[model samples]
Target chain A: MKRRDFLIGAAATGAFTAAPHIWRKDTSLARASNGEIKVGVLFSLTGTTGIIEESLNKATLLAIEEINDAGGINGMKIVPVVEDPASDPATFAVKARKLVVGDKCVSVFGSYTSASRKAVLPVFEKRDNLYWYPTLYEGRECSKNVIYTGAVPNQQQDEFIPWLVEKFGKKFYLIGSNYIYPKEENNYCKKLLEELGAEVVNEEYVPLGHSEFSSVINKIQSTQPNVIFSTVVGDSVVALHRQYRAAGLDPDKMPMASLTTSENEVAAMGGDAAAGHFTSAPYFMVHQSPENERFVEAYKSRWGGDKVTHFVSEPSYFQIYLFKQAVEQLAASDIDPTTIREAVKGQELIAPQGKVHLEAENLHTWLWPKIAMAKSDGQFEVLRDSKEWLKPEPYAAYPNQHCTADGLVQS
Target chain B: MEFFLQQIMTGLSIGSILLLIALGLAIIYGSMGVINMAHGEFVMLGAYGAWAMNAFFGVGLLPSLIVVFLGVGALGWLVERGVIRFLYRRTLDTILATWGLGVMLQQMIRLSAGGELRYVEMPSVLTGTVGILGVDVPGYRVFIFVFVAALFAVTWYLMFRTTFGTKLRAVVQDRSVASCFGIDADKVYSLTFAYGAGLAGLAGALVAPLKSVSPEMGTTYVVDAFFVVVLGGVQSLFGTVASALMLGELTGGLAYLWNDTIAKALVLLAIIVLIRFRPQGLFVSRIRS
Candidate 1:
């Protein structure tokens, strides 16, 4: 009788521990005569990534407000359930699971880092929901469950590297924070640089959250590479920029270019420090267009004039409006995850950067990359703009991506 | 030769900061027989204090060091008296309790101050470079080196030449006998702990301009400080200094040759191998049993 009681107790404990998993499998997210279309908004609103992601979160809200003001999506109010990942990858996955399984969000949108996106991808894919990742990243890899709204290497590096090689004598010195994105981007750039007969003098990566760059600075002074390609991110950006200037290296003579530097960083590092540096992105605050002007005005008016927007901020704002258009065009009364995902494909919106479209082959957008030079006032002056919207290359190969990628002509 | 010189300079500058961080632990743990795992959180509080003074009161980093020391030091005194006083003589319990206190303090800071990185501007006078022997060394780095030297002197004098230090040493060696001699062992212990905490705050204040101040910043420093303390013979102040210098140089020298990740790994491995040989650390205190 005691043995039987022990077995019963063990079984009860097992059942209790497994309860959360059992609760996670429920997929009753489809709207039935919708009172409100619920969407999950996830962002690192606090922690190390907070300063950068804070603006993006506000941008998401601004877009949602604009949509809700315009008679709501599908004549139903769009309700948002926001969750903070606190800049932790593990926490991002946990909050993502809660957003999808518990909150029953129709679609989840957010993730500033590639690491966080990778963490949350499996959850979204398993749960059969769309994840709109808005951060620009190194090229390659795609998922049906996720949309690549950010600029890829082909759109960003490919355009900028050639321009740099032609303009500056290319004894390239590379530096980045030790992360997958920087490593991958630098490798891709090196491959491209070698193809054009440019020499990569040295490459180095300091750890993320790294404060000091004195050793790297000394090395740079000695080597004196013609072009410096950097991919440093986060709080480290502020330190590196200030230290570089204090070291007395002329930015114009050996100007640095980054895939990650944006208006937000420039402002944070304080104005005039980032002058003469170049950054390539799909959008900048000083973009010349009626759409950009109106978007910038709306952003400043809503968030206050002092709050500056950047590359990731614009994509996040546009993605909400894009999602709304996709859902409204579905023409299905029961707007579930499936209908929303399908409707989003092959949809085009004149974003703040200009016209962006979701080409059906891979769930990536066609974005126009611009190379801008940082001015003293914490703003970018557009140096060069692309001829048209450049399609993303998630799996763009060594050299023949422009000539022959499978999904090139599908649009 | 120039590159080697540069690497050594980098090491020394880095090592000085490590020494500042580890000194507090060495004193408190060495004298009080209590391991304060909340040492890093105390450093974080110091950084926050400096940042607050700079942002709100417009006090410069140089002027705010004293305030940071007193503010964070008072808190540390309270923590030692309130929570740590009971856990004396129980090493395991002290470690556990202090670690728990560290987590609670981290969460409290995160809740109240928010987890975003706070900026502390470097004074314009010290932001430029000073040319030394045909190399441009940052003025701030030079200032830090000088400041660390000054701090080392001050602390050494306090520990070796002062009456409080004699009393603390007496209490640490023989608490019952020191009490019999009318030395108030408890008061000495409390004061020693607060001084250690104040030293940690001074370290943080000095570092505020160089790095982005955040709640989690102390975690990294404390781990490095532990290494310095452990590898230097935790009871010997001079040993802590030597270990910190050696470790920082190894890291900087390796970083010149390899990536920061591999360099850090190599330095850590080197420390482990060294500790394997000398488990009691490089130097041990001589005490009559």
Candidate 2:
């Protein structure tokens, strides 16, 4: 009888240990398992970029909802952990750390400007997590930990410059807000323009928050370049455009091609000012793909019909799918980040713009960009499109230029 | 020789705007001993007010200027009566409170106008360039220089000559004594705050044609204005004007040669050294006995 009692006690202890193991595995699989993945959305919800990012955040939420409704990634429900960076770089870094280390988010997707991205880069690198940054940036950076889903200089400026040259010829006036991205991007363009046998009439910069451009606008008017290549960002774009129009400089006569101005800027520029301007971005409001149509409808339904969609939001939406594809390819109940990272490499996504393929070298994606004419309604009428996806070359291919494919990768 | 003269003219044009803004800050700090952190916001308010008037009424430049001046002045009065009056005796509290108020005002503007810069149309008269010593200077900038100089002359006359100005100055020197002299110190304070704010509004309206009008655009000027106030003895208007012109020339001239960041850093270093030598400022004036 004593022997029987000892055996029963041992069995009870064994069951107690086994029960927790079973429940933990089950809960883990249920919450973040085969049917669950936790991804973080970091955005500047309260900073200078907040007005632009609000639309992006809403679109991101809408995309997640639609994806979940369509049975999620590999039959797993996608969970998004949203964090507000408040537009402060230091705060962005802190939130990025919390999202990666504390929440154990597999990937973080957001950042409007280079400053914010630079702030969050270390966090992703230290944590060895995936970071999908969706903004046009000054290229010359290649990192193993981050995937640049936006336009590189080659993707944006290469085509943009040649197109301007064909339309408006070589003499160009360059204006931009004084900042790293503008300065670097314009510098790249200046090199490219000279390579293409074009002349830079005048290159001017205003302080980032400089509202008055009477001086600059007057300068541009007097210079009378064949075209104005503007790299202005934030509120400055609207001001510059309005001042351009006010100066009686006709767009048709001396056209303005902007790399930074998007549909989001049109609302700020007002219909009268932004109308008839040309903008080049990877995404536009009036893209005629079925996927984009569905995205627009869903976004409108989510954020009201009057809400306008912009370029930044679409890539943010695409990030969720990209993460899901990575998760599905790994196909493990508990995702090992290294495996997920491997899976993310060479992942081809049928995005709203077109098929986007991840470059194995720098982890930047090769996505087709759409050139759109700004309409009065704050929507882009896709004027011209490169239906074929342009492979992203972060460095210039010209022999004269020092930029090389390996230039982006630091030793 | 031409380039040097051109730089001076450019410096002077920029200096005019800086001086107007610094003058407004100087007056409020001189009278109330409060920094009035929302001074920039008042400028923003005036710019927006002018823009709105132009949009709604299609008013000419002069009319829009008048509307902005009066509208922003009323806003100043409201802000003074509703918010600033309560925190006057406590200097640190006034500064902190005004800072909060400034942020709140910027956010409100953002909500109303979105976070984009609005363009204020320069009238036909303000367009084009004027040749100065064989150098082409923007016509609007020259206008700005003349307008600000006239504004200073008017402000100087009013402050040093008028009965109301004497009462305001009396209150600044000693509020209890001014009250004992039946000056109605509270009323004098309110008027002085409103006048300072009105001046800022005028400065904003004037600058709208030259700069983008955005919500947080004011923040960029606040630090520069602070430098101006401290460099010029904060209690003295003439000192404020002189310091603003010197700083503007120093910054603009340096910016022409150096990278903007390096130029700003140099200015900051110079200011630090000056402050070490004369903690009060370049020009110090004793209060009226």
Candidate 3:
């Protein structure tokens, strides 16, 4: 069969017979004098989240290339056996197993959405491998086999939500994709909103790819809430925001804030349409920092300036270096899970977003979170910045019940 | 009372978009039995065509509709003549071939367009909301409701009153008899396929403003269109309309009460129960094979 047909067959079946991956014996991830170190780079190169995941994949490859160029990892070159999960959870699991059993890579680095991460978590845990996931997500999750360099729930919300509440009114509306991240985030959001004596007027969940929001918009108009807290991701973000704007609801009057919307989405939706929206992230392309400026220049020179890099791509780029730093710290000929995981605990990097240090216990990172308003130029105007790094709370510390303004239990 | 009216209006508008999509599939897969899997890709093409016209030539949405109809319809004609025409008798092969053809088209657009979501701006006149029954209804949605009604009337007239429609229906029922009566079956099939494709393109162009234009944008639409076509009965256009209305209203009302994902699950279950009882659809034609 032709090469094109072969790709279609593989995509259709989720796994093809002639993948050309030699069924190698499950070997150890040891550095050899003559052999190259293979690292698994699995991400969605195609599918629903492919557009954003493509940048993550590039960031991983660039970091690996940079490491290999800098005299290799202890004089042994690192090679990546890339696999495409195609944004399907089952396909992600199948590829993760292949990376562990067939390629025998030291660790895998990828996954943008939480569902994909959860799917591959068992594979890594079962085999005692490392999966470096670098996207800020809904918190309350920690796996012994995964290094989550992304900001957790508290790190993203503490600085931004309070500021928003102070600036806007006390009433809020929650909108998001019906998934783990959005649901969990909205749950945490409701608790926090109530704790601050704010009222959550309405909460709604739509499927991931849902673009039609007329009925929902009608409900929004009638209710006329203070703010719309959104965790909606992917193409639906563009759809919902565009439709919301078209329906004559001035975002300036009733702002829409999201944990997921970033510079990448702003660029996709055009500045004119997505302008005035609020987003909180650990890193923004418009951030003013010496390290960020240099990193942005390097990224632009490598991959044209037209392409925008967000928090996920930045963390993804640094996570690979974080891996290399840990491996170099070991200074041993072998690279295994235990050594890498232990070394990663206290590892630090002067990443594009100032500094990131992995907290040992939770395996989460301590990084600065900033808030920005999207501009029509497809960039952001940084409105708020936390000068001090917030501690990572994998599961936020909060009372189960919400307290009203009078110090009485609301429910 | 206002809430009930608003919900029903929402359902009708949603059903109109579904009708626009399923109408084309009714002609191709319903009557023609070709199972054109690339129907959604045809919608994507029409969206892109509208985007290109507006960006390059400063053409507005109304004029672009006509251009997209002809352009995409012509492309459909070429595909039917070159590929689908040969595999008409082989059901399984036709399904697989169309499926493969769809993947190729998706990848081809992905490679050329770079896979980022593209937005098509709405015209200024359709951007605001109108007060209806003490509620604000989106203007573009109201436009879609009216536009679909007019299109349906025109389609009905063309099918029932025109010579071409008679020839097309004759070829569909008995190809040899139609051939014996000097009605060229080949021309009828080709025109019928092109017309169905043209309708899909129109659906795409109209929805481009509300939905972002991406290579995979058609996946959701095609799935919903298939549900409408199959549950409504393969051979009846009115069946497509009635089924789309039922499914659309059920989804909107359920989603308004619950959430979108749950409403979608319930709708699928409802269709399953529906098809179980009425296998021949809501309206079955009495024509003999």
Highest-scoring model, TM-score: 1
User: Where in model 1 is the C-alpha error above 4 Å?
Assistant: A1-32, A46-51, A86-91, A94-104, A166-168, A272-275, A300-305, A375-377, A397-411
Residue B239, model 1: lDDT of 91
TM-score of 1: 0.89
lDDT for each residue of candidate 1 in A253-328, tens digit (9 for 90 to 100): 8888998989877865665568999999999999989988998999999999887778999999899988988888
TM-score of chain B of each: 0.97, 0.96, 0.97
Better of 1 and 2 by TM-score: 1
- Write candidate 2's Cα lDDT for A1-411 as tens digits: 699999999999889897876545554533265456777888877777887776767767777888899998778777889999988899989999998878877777878888889999898878788788877788766667777888887787767788889887888988877887777778788888988999998887766765545455545655679888888887777767765665556778787888877876777676667777788888887888898888888888888988777777888888777777878876555575566778887888888887888777677788787777787776778878885788776655333433322434332
* TM-score of every prediction relative to native: 0.89, 0.82, 0.89
> Each predicted complex: what DockQ?
0.39, 0.29, 0.44
Q: List, in the given order, the native-contact fraction of each candidate.
A: 0.53, 0.17, 0.61
Per-residue lDDT tens digits of candidate 1, residues B160-250? 8999888888888888999999999878888889989998888888777776677888888888888999899978888988998898787
lDDT of 2: 0.77
Candidate 3: tens digits of C-alpha lDDT, residues A1-411 = 999999898786664345423344223335332557678998899988888998999878878887888887777788888999998999999999999888877789989888899899899989989999999987676577888888887888888888889999888989998788888888778878878999988899888888878678767776788889999888888889888877778888799998988888876666777888899889998898897887778777778877778899999899988888888776555567767888888898898888889888778889999999988888899898898998887667344433221222323
Interface CA RMSD, all predictions: 1.9, 4.7, 1.5
Candidates 1 and 2 compared by lDDT, better number:
1
Which clashing pairs does model 2 show? A35-A76, A35-A77, A211-B211, A211-B212, A212-B210, A212-B211, A212-B212
RMSD for each of the candidates: 6.0, 6.4, 9.0
